[model samples]
Target chain A: MLTGVVPDARYWSYTLYGADDYLIPNQDQRYGYNAATMDYVPRDTLNPEASDQWIDQYQIKISADQQEGNWLPAGNNKALSITLRLYNASPTVYENLATIALPEIIKVN
Target chain B: MKKTLIYFLLFCASALVGRTVAIHYLPDYIYSRFSKMALSRPGAAVNQFSVLMAPDENAKLVVKPNPDFAYATLFYDLTDGPIHILGAMPDSIYWSVALYQENTVNFYVKNDMQYDSDTLNIIISDDAMDQEADIEQIVSPEKTGFVLIRVLVAERDEAHQKAISDYLNALQIP
Candidate 1:
């Protein structure tokens, strides 16, 4: 399980890559979940115009089997790595890149 | 017994030499080959931008490409002279331009937030030239390298694609 608060940025995503450094091939054509695809709701009073919409938190699961929310396939017994990309990041995001709260990757049986 | 020991020693010596040579030359050879392949694509040439669609599993031009980004690439060859990049950012989108050396080290990156103006007038060269007014000059470490312009298109919407494409196409090399 991977969980964290989304960074304040115009775009963010978690992409899964296999040991070969190529995207893990899956049937759903789903390799990642970006800010738009994650379907984060507005944080402040459901106001779409509010600037904090991108700051909503997320929980993603990586498994071979189909999962409920924000799932990316683990691609059938292969070593994997997740890459997080932040585009047009805010000043805070850039400055605190090292100290920022990254999503915790928990191994669940 | 003596013959076998000499043979084992010879094998180890060759293995070390082979490993050393491969380690020293393989990355450069691979990058050179990759660059040649990239430049051979349709509409991809020296000093010109080749706009690419959002990356999918088959997109090998870059590793770990973000699907939400529309990319424009320039396989720059600065042997002749300095190359000028003139462009304008599309409104309300995340945009950045990054410079990479032939060895794949990203040397410079400028995002939209860093620029005060929507329009960009940048010059990339290997040598110092007479400073031109109203243009930002960047010295490149390699005469031949790559330029990447990334524009965020979160939804893959048609309007966003068109806008990004237009923005990339408008970059002039004069």
Candidate 2:
């Protein structure tokens, strides 16, 4: 399992890709989820306040098994990489790409 | 032995030539096909930006399809002058315009945050990147190229997407 968080921007999302840069095919037909696609997350899961846009603080979960809130299904036994895209990023966000850090991943019981 | 050596040399020469030609012309061929795809779609026409994806929808604009940002495209010719882009993005949404040369080189790109504009006013030209223009100028290395605009659709707001589409349709090179 892997997890990460992107800073606040007008819009931001992380997409998982195979070694070839193409999206990893999954049964759900979902590649990634942004703040706008909150409906994809299970109802009332995670921080409800982080409902829209890349909030001040939030974590995205990626794993083969189903997890709650912003669950990105990683294909079985396949190596994948994530691409984070920030649209209309502020100077604070874009300039601090190196300085700012993504959230740490923790195993789900 | 002599015949085999001659045939082998000829084959090597032919393969090298074929590879070079493919490398040189393949980009234009691919770009043309994708540019045509953007043009022939419904509501799309030359010089005007057309939204390829609808709200809450995903599609193949050219090859790889993305479900996140809504793609709006324009196939433009700079034989006349420059095409002017003028509009205002809705508040709290992310958007960007990427200008690609007809031969498929991405020459310039700017997002809503980076752009020096409140009401979107930018010029697209092939003359030069530093040309004298009252508004911000985007130089397309090729006289003719494709302009791709991406606007994020917020939630199930089809209305916002429609608004942006209408704004894009109203833009024309003058």
Quantify all predictions' global Cα lDDT against the true fold: 0.81, 0.67
lDDT of 1 by residue, B18-131 (tens): 997777777577778887888888777788888886777787766766777788889898889999999788776778889988767789999887877888889999988889
On residues A51-92, what C-alpha lDDT tens digit does candidate 2 reach at each position?
553434455677778777667777663566776666666788
lDDT (0-100) at residue A24 of candidate 2? 58
lDDT of 2 by residue, B65-148 (tens): 455666667788888788887766655466778888756778888777776654667887776656555578776777788878
**Which 10 consecutive positions of candidate 1 chain B have the poorest summed lDDT?**
B152-161
Q: List residue ranges in candidate 1 displaced over 4 A.
A: A8-10, A25-28, A41-55, A64-68, A73-78, A88-99, A107-109, B1-27
Clashing pairs in model 1? none
Q: What is the lDDT of candidate 1?
A: 0.81
RMSD of 1: 5.1
* Position A60, candidate 1: lDDT: 85
